[model samples]
Target: MKIGIGSTNLAKIEAVQRVFSENDEIISVRVPSGVSDQPFSDEETIEGAIQRAKKALETTNADLGIGLEGGVTETPYGLMLCNWGALYSKTDHSPIIAGGARILLPDEISERLRTGEELGPIMDDYCMRENIRHHEGAIGIFTNGLITRGEMFSHVVRMLKGQFIYRMNG
Candidate 1:
């Protein structure tokens, strides 16, 4: 099977690769999220993922399209990290959406986000590291390397695959 990943980000691409078979052809394309650079709510995040999946499918001849989007949302406690993934196939009219792990950001980081700063740059400054999103990401920093962004998205991909399998079998 051929799979097209919406984003060219290494973490997103790696997550999709981990879920698929070695023989499957996986390609990553730089697709638009169709939302703000920093999505501020679950609805927006999920919408962005679905949009990317659809655009990827439209652009590629792959049998399946995958999209991963990470954003932040405000809650009673604080601003929290939200990650969403979507899978689309030409044969299926609807897409399968799944959510990855969510975690509250540190108050310091949340404060910065509230000022209209994007998480990627904020994290880079806070962690004193360059392009942390391509590596461990904020999840890894919060979890002390226990869980990275790639791992979180991988779980979402696995869930999407499970849904597809069930739909086919049942």
Candidate 2:
């Protein structure tokens, strides 16, 4: 099967690759999120993922398309970093969506995000690293590398793949 992934981010590409067989082709394409660079709500993030999946599928002519998006959401405790993944099939109009690990950001980071700063840059400054999102990400930094961004997204992809398998079998 050919799977077209919406984003060319290495982490997302690697994550999606983990769930599929070696024989299956995984194509990575750079696509827009169709939302703000930093999605502020769960609904917006999910919408972005779905839109990306549709675009990727349409562009690649693949059997399936996958989209992964990361954003921040305001919670009662504080602001949380969230990631979502979506899968789309041409035959099935309904998409299968799943979410990755969510982590509460430090007030310092949250404050900057509230000021309209994107998380990638804020995390780079806070962690004193470059492009942390493309690497371990906030979850990895907070968890001491126990849970990486790729791993988190991979889990969500696995869940979406499960849904696809069930649909195919039933």
Candidate 2 error regions (>4 Å): none
List, residue by residue over 1-170, the lDDT tens digit for candidate 1. Answer: 98998998888989988999999999889999999999999999999999989888887878999889999999998999999999998789799999989999999999989888999999999999998898899999999999999999999999999998887788
Clashing pairs in 1: none
TM-score per candidate, chains pooled: 0.98, 0.97
Worst 10 residues of 2 by lDDT: 127-136
Worst 10 residues of 1 by lDDT: 53-62
- Clash statistics: count for each candidate: 0, 0
Cα lDDT of all candidates, in order? 0.92, 0.92
Residue 61 C-alpha lDDT in model 1: 77
Residue pairs with colliding backbones in model 2 are none
lDDT of 2 at 147: 96
